[model samples]
Target chain A: MAEIAATASKRDVGRGRGLVAAIAWRSLWRNRRRTWLTAGGIAFGVSLVVFSMAFQAGSYGDMIYNATSFLTGQVQIQRADYIELSRFEQTIGDATETLRRVEQQAGVLSATARVEAFALVSVDERSFGAQVLGVDVERERQVVNFFDRLSRGRVMAGPDETVIGSGLARNLNADLGDEIVVLGSAKRGGVAAMVLDIVGIFDSGISELDRSLLFVPIAAVQNEFGLGDEVHTIVVRTQVDDSRAVVEALGHQLPEGLSVRNWDEVLPEIRQGIDVDRLGGMFMYAIVLMIITFSIVNTFTMTVFERLREFSMLKAVGMRPGKIVLMVQIEALLLWAIGVGIAMGLMVPLLAWLQSSGIYLGEAIVELAKQYYITDRIYPALGPASLLAAPAVMLAATQIAAFASSLRIYWLRAAAGVRAAE
Target chain B: MSSDIVVSCKGVSRTYQEESVPVHALRGVDFEFARGEFVSIAGPSGSGKSTLLNVIGGLDRPDAGTITVDGVELNGLNETELSDLRLHKMGFVFQSYNLIPVLSALENVEFIMQLQGVGPAERAERAMSMLDSLDIVDLADRRPGDMSGGQQQRVAIARSIVTNPVLLLADEPSANLDSATTEDLLQLLRRLNEERGVSILTATHDPIVMSYAQRQVNLRDGAIVEDSAAKVA
Candidate 1:
């Protein structure tokens, strides 16, 4: 009995491997064009998914960075009442103490205080409404790199000097060393106005900021507006490794009249924009996947119909219906693997090149993006998750499509079919 | 010697449904083939010869009656068991030569051994030996499409015999071949039966095929009309 069992097992192993090899090789080589076409369909679908996902991811990353570093810091700490109402009556008095405490917290990389107000700036006859920012130049530069992005002149050099955005400069017909007048209502119901020389013009690649941002020394803006010893907000930069933890900690420790917001929440609209972009990407991917599914199904069905006589011959030779089903499945899987593999091989380098070179949306799309999403540039960034996820999704989709097309072969009765054909 | 019955069929019937009508392809066919016998099932087109072949080969199930091959009842076995019976004990050569176009002659011959669970080394050895026996060893690596009709038919025969099956069923094996190739194939079949003691049951309408057989079972419509043995004495 033991000898019989051993012999049976040996035969099984030998036959199993041989059968698998013969079936896989023959099935792959038999209908070369059909197999390749199915594979190409899967690869095309996967490549579209991978490239689009990578591009969308990169663009989102760029959008957030261009919006935040170019304007808002990673985290913003402000008076609770100031956030809710922005009333001139409520402000953070002695923000230096809070700034010192925030800087000491773990992951808190840098901290600076700023006061912001709506005002109008005029250069010669041209005037535009602007958000005037009162900043500690050294700390602001550390957080935002505003000095390096200056397109024309230097950043604020002293208390009376200011830096206007490039778009604002273009609109106002102003340049470095030009005098601009700032006009607005002060905190105490008194009209406030000041004359400052533009020290530089900076472009943050964000159209909104470029058109309406004016940076001045924090002390000068405070004195000119008659807001004594009060800072409107404290901008903090947290270490990348501990940004979320630091934000949560700061949210707890901040005083009642103050509120803290991470970069994500500070720009809810940007997050919403990203979500919309992701949905658009999903819609496009679904369309492409559907097209690929149809192509694969069509090819497989045609192959099956064309090879009916061959299948009949296999059945006549005593191959089980189940083995026939398995053979068809293996063929489908091979085609899918080949197609997706080729597509991925082609797309990886293509997407990497795109990541480095970026897809130029042309001037019209750039302007449209600026007007719609408040940014001028679109950069593709693929995260690790997006890169890995796109391929998995595509493979799963192809498998389902292939399986659906294999049903006819699986249920085929060799005996009946062959007799009928004969 | 009577104990060596390769196939025994009793009251076997097959009905194929077409559109909404039933076409009886075989009716109460009682047949038997002995071990080492080269038998031919002769019938005109639309007769029951192919149907009888299919039923005996376990490629089709009879609507009624029983078929026993090597004393194993084919009707009682399930689909898998029947498939195993075909894979292990019986080999089939088709009228069309039905060799897989993608596979080379050697691979086509190796396929039955593959189905029978033969290892790569053994399958290669047996397939090459079979092709050599049929005098087509040089064409072993050529695909069916790359070979002539006679060569393809010879490869098909080699594939049928590669697994060392007890019964080799050939359905019009020489239908597509020229007269010379047909004579060559008949000689090969005669040699296999005479030397190897392999039981063969072939279905054909050709008188040439009938002349080579030791026994002929003639079918008309759906029933056997005559069963006659050639006088070898």
Candidate 2:
């Protein structure tokens, strides 16, 4: 019996709430043109917000993926001075052992060691300074995309064998099965010199990488450099999109001379580029939305004044001042919902079309990509945050405007309000 | 009918600040209305008839006197408490803008009941019954804009009485009505007062409204000049 009575009482309260909400919602449609104009402002603001956010997010992903795939891995275990100096003396003494330990880390998918040195290569009276990367033939593929990125012969077959980049081969006038002289100042005692056979050549489409890269077996690099057991860097690939977890996990457990550097640390310039772009996007969003807020305030203030008599009638009819505020906020939310819905409707198709046909960055970007190792085509990605944040900000800003304008209504005296001119 | 007082005022005075002058709308007035009695405050424009009714209805507070409704001091209650009193106990009929423009005739009636937390089924039933009694059941779904002046007044009456309020205050309700409509509205108020035992107060300059009151109070320049009991029609 008590439960039944309680349910009935709750039902009555709910009925009252439903009626209040219905009245508020109906009030929005009373001035259709004003409502549409306000909704249009929100749509314009949020469309820009959504488009910029999605573009920035997608561009960041592409840059990170390309940067990591082409050159850097997710994390790098390197000597403390190797990044800055690149000196042969600053080598990881037990790089193979470090690679084994990193591979066993929780999120680590694969790991490879490399001994890189700036060496002079000569073939048939032509010579060029090339960066020789001594790598494990099988393990290097798991870290970088170089193995599958081949155009000519395969990866280095054995010791004293090398795979030269097409640009470097062209510069040195070298061909497949040609023997090239490579000389480097070894860290131990002597000048390291070798006549290595070029068994393969490759083109990665990145002109910088193709211009000055040569790959040889790590064992050969160790023997030639007179450093039998040391490699300069150990690169690890994590199984996840973010490497922070793996980097933090292994940072504390590494040997005395080694530190774990994630992609951001290894490539701070790329991280800064993404950060600057994100900040620019947010700055644009804030400016547009602040104008939208003022528009809301102006729109609602005019509405509140025009409807003073109506509000006064409602007050006389026993509508609370707080409910009046809620009614205005409901109007704001309704406008936001309509605007965001339209923007999303328009954005989805546009983004899909752009995604299908990747955005061409034009001549400047294409030249920059050729000059550096950057990719030309950017595929913008839309994340869940962009999908959620735009509407959230629009509604919040509009509600604040609505609340600020509705404050004027609470000061409306019922007696004067009833007599106030329409 | 019982003669217990529903509204009482003592030495009620109000001043209005208009530009640079203070206009005394009401001055040291004492008044009382008994339960179920229909009284009309009649005067010319700016004679404080509206101000007196506004004070009695808790829509405006007296600056220098006390107004009491149903044992609750009007000056002592906060805005929210006063709103609750009006929602549950008092009804109003304005001279114009009586109905919310967006609401239908039926919905306007249900709005009061809904605000009072009446069950949906009960609110709809009582609203329909009120519309039926007012002879406007066919216009239940018609919005206020679609209704004629007379028809809208009838709908306003339905809304006012649907809650069964203890006091029904009408301020110049017949101001915009034609003579025939004024006569009809006055008769309807008389019927509601007699049938439902509702205490009625009306502030108006309309002679038609003044004629139907059980008692009439006359005001001039913010002071009551005469009080007399008149025969009910």
Candidate 3:
């Protein structure tokens, strides 16, 4: 023993890792029912968290796509002050050149130039203030598809033709083919006027746009308004999920006065709506995870307290307190791994099924869904963010609870502990 | 300070607080236990025999004075150093047998040697040899929960002496055993003492245990009252 002791003093003590790990592994099964129940609870919580995150991501994606597809076009480029001031004088000078430059950027599916001016429309007895959007008819087709929702006639086919919203058409008590005169102030403070034949009336499902917006060919508006080869904004449709990427890609390349805006910036209420809904969902997930964490803490506390005598015996037999604490931590990690593994096994396929076979909300919400540019079918999207969030939280929380509960061993006196057991 | 003395304690005093009132478990115990000697500390309940055993084994510290085990002072050593000293040089046999429940008998016996960084093959051979000496090699793979009290105590004894410590401390080793089993246990300790010359110090109230010892020290209250060896001299 003295010879062995002398040799041991040279080598590292507490190095018998295999038996310690084995001891830890076997100890977890001492209460098989409790272990399984706790692991099952973790699995249930993780599955719920991952599944709900997938659904949220899927729904948010759909909402953003729907809202941006028709009006915002995912990304837009305009004069630095144009979005805030909406000044007719603040316009991009080379509309065709700007459109060409924006279309050339990567991830840009399509780009269209438009001129916007606030005007008064009059047809005989009725007159109301409206926002007239001057758009390049052919290129606009590739950017926005509101024209597909036209209720009467067709999209503007000539320089003097226009498409008015359904609400505006109803307000003016006007029909397709009726001519209306638009009057506005152009750049240089001159009177800009035009008589456009109402060729189409569209119900965009958005009341704000339907009540106050109109569209006409860019050339006629430019010709009458005396705005030579200039447009207010260039809208770009992107294939990417986030419009900010395209905006960043186009940031340095654009002319100095031009500023790029993502769909969120263009339509802040949609972003705000998604953010508020996401916060509420996160709060719910946090509550679920916190509950699971508390249960884990309780489980570990009971385990350590009940095993104090056994731990004291180990210590008396020459086991370091750190080794014993390490064993408990290993048990926690194993539990976490088992729970998360089962959760992944169950959730991956479940999410795949939900992703492919979307949940249909039925016709009751079709109209209401349409108002927010959402559809009846919502597909749950499984991405990296949703895949990893729950398991990471469980792992971190489990280790913390285990370490906290296992700390009592460090303060336990070996002889007192053994005697207390007696 | 002589090399022949396995344990030395001088003016050792330990006090415990039970509900804020001080209980003097040990008051100024001074003694030297020689190598290869089988000694028993005999006392009634709360007579401080167990406390003296604990202090000498380094399982508990003396609040005043000093304890030196095999020339290493217990007063100056840190917790880890004390643990190492216990692991390498001292062995403990409890009345309850205190074998780790999760470990098989063989693993429990090999546990201390493993902590000493012995190779796996040597640890297994030595553990089996020790169990064989105790006539319990057949119970090697059996867990403590699957064994009777006598069999468990034999395994605990095998674990304690497997690493061949300088001193073995038994605190009421026969307290939970029947008469027949106690005879077998005492014979085994005597045989180990005769054959291998291992020093042992046991604290117990049992007359049978005290009868098996070569020398007996009797205590009352918190101090030693009689020494059989001194009386014999």
Candidate 4:
């Protein structure tokens, strides 16, 4: 009895190993071109995912940095009513103490209080609208390097001095040292107007910001607009690594009238825009992957059909149907592994070039990007997640395709397979 | 009836359903094969020789009646049991030399032993011995496609007897071979039956195959027409 059991186990192991080797050899050599082609399809699908994801990551990183550095700081604190209502009435009466409290918070790196309003700027005949930001030059410099981004003249250093973005300057035909008139309603109501010399021209690499921001000294804005000890918002910066935690902590500690928001909250429209762009990218990738999967399935089905006779012969010699299925599955896995390996091999060089040189679209595409997404050059950056996820996705997709085709082989009747040969 | 009968069939019948039409391939037939017997079932086309062989080999079940091989009643066993019976107690050879083309000659013979749960080292030893007995040991490493039709058939024969089955079934084993190859195969079958004590039942229309059998059963339209023990010296 024991000898029978021992023999049975030994045969099982031998058959298992033989089955694996047979499947591996059949998968590679029987349909050489088709095997390589299927592998190519998987490789292409995986590479697209990896490259596109890396590009999106890089683009989003750029957008976030530009948005935050151009206007809002890493974090912003405002009256709770101001964020919900966005009305002029929600301005804080005493921003000085609030600014002090924010700066004292753990992980708080820098803090500044500012007033903001929307108005029109005109130089001679040309006129354009702009968002007027009131800032303390030194504190504002600590949060955002508006002065460092100047293309013409110096940043505002006095109460009456102002800096205009390059696009805003172009729209209004205003130049450095030229006086531009700003017109809008003051905080109290009636009318408010100011004429200030353009001290600097800044370019933030974002069309929306570059085309419509005018920065001036807070005292000057206060006097011209009758703001009377009120500030619109307080911008804060935290240590980079601890920014999210700092924002969450500050959000819970703020008083009822005040609200703190991260960069994402401050720019909901931009975030939503990015999310839509990401969805579109994902949809495009999915379409490409589906086509690749179909090609692979077709190749595998043909391979199986061609080898029908051989499989029957194996079965006749006591090969189990389940073992046949396992053999085919192992073949698929080998194909996937090879495909992913080739893609990884190709991607390393391609990604390096893309990261260093960037992807150059034609002038027309660049213009379109400027008109819509506000950037001309597309830079792809490698993220760990994007790099590692490509092979996994390919393996899963190929395995599914292989398993679906393997079922036909598994359910094949041994007698029927042999009958054709007879 | 001798108690030494290794195979006994009592009124066995097989009907196949083809496209919703019932085709009676075999009528009720009774037969018996003794241990270590070399037997042949001779018939023309559609005479139920292959069907009868299939039932005895446990590759297919009869629609009615009982088949007992070495005391195990085949009709009483389920599909898995029948598979186990085939794996352990029966081996098959086909006219087409149905050997997996991807496997070498040695691997083909080793397959049955593998299925029987033999270890690799021992399976190789036994398979090599079988190939040596047939004088095809030199072609052990060559795949079936690389060898001649006769060599492939020899491998198939080796595969059949590797597990030392209680019964070996061959269906038209010489139909695709030349006269010389057929004679060589017949000599091997004769030696295996005489020397190894393995029971073999072959279904063939060839007179050359019938000449080697110790007993011959002739079938016509699914019924046995003649049963004779060969007059051997």
lDDT of 4 by residue, A148-197 (tens): 77777887878778998889988887788899999988877968899898
Report the candidate with higher lDDT, 2 versus 3. 3
Specify the CAPRI tier of model 3: acceptable
lDDT tens string, model 2, A1-422? 23323443454344466666777678888899988888888888888888878777777777776778666788898888777777788888866677788888888888899998889999979999999898998888888787777788877778989998999999988899899999888877689998899888888776787989999998888888888788888888874375889988898788876878889888888888878878887888899999988988898898788788888888887777777777778877877888888889998788878876878888777867643344677665677887778889888888888898899778777888876632
Q: What is the lDDT of residue B233 in candidate 2?
A: 25
Residues B1-233, candidate 2: write the lDDT tens digits. Answer: 12388888899999999997999999999988888989999999999998898888778888988887776677877666667767767899888846888889999999888877787899899999999988899999999999998899899888888988889999898888999989988889999999888889999888889999989999999999988852232
Give the winner by DockQ: 2
- Which residue segments of model 2 deviate by more than 4 Å? A1-15, A81-90, A118-131, A146-155, A163-187, A197-214, A252-257, A349-365, A369-376, B1-3, B229-233
Chain A of model 3 scored by TM-score = 0.94
Docking class of 4: acceptable
Residue by residue across B1-233, what tens digits does model 1's lDDT show?
Answer: 25788899999999988897999989999888889999999999979898899889887789999998877788877666666777778888887788877778888888777766677788899888888889999998898889998888888888888777899999888888899989999999999989998899999999999999999999998899888852332
Docking class of 1: acceptable
Residue A174 C-alpha lDDT in model 4: 78
lDDT of 1 by residue, A1-422 (tens): 23322443455433454454566657676677877777777887887787778777777766766556655777888888778898765778877788888898888888889989889999989999998989998998777756677888777778889999989999999988899999988889887788999988888677788999999999888988888888888887764336678888988887766788888778888888889988988898888888887887787677677776777777667665556666666666677778878986898777777767766777778766653433454555656765666567656665666566666764566656664554
When summed lDDT is taken over every stretch of 10 residues in candidate 2 chain A, the lowest stretch is A1-10
Q: In angstroms, give how far residue A262 of model 2 lies from its true place.
A: 1.3
Estimate, for each residue in B35-84, the C-alpha lDDT of model 4 and write its tens digit: 99999999998899988987787666788989998777877664435555
* lDDT of each candidate versus the true structure: 0.79, 0.83, 0.88, 0.80
| Model 1, residue pairs in steric clash | A15-B117, A58-A380, A58-A381, A80-A257, A80-A258
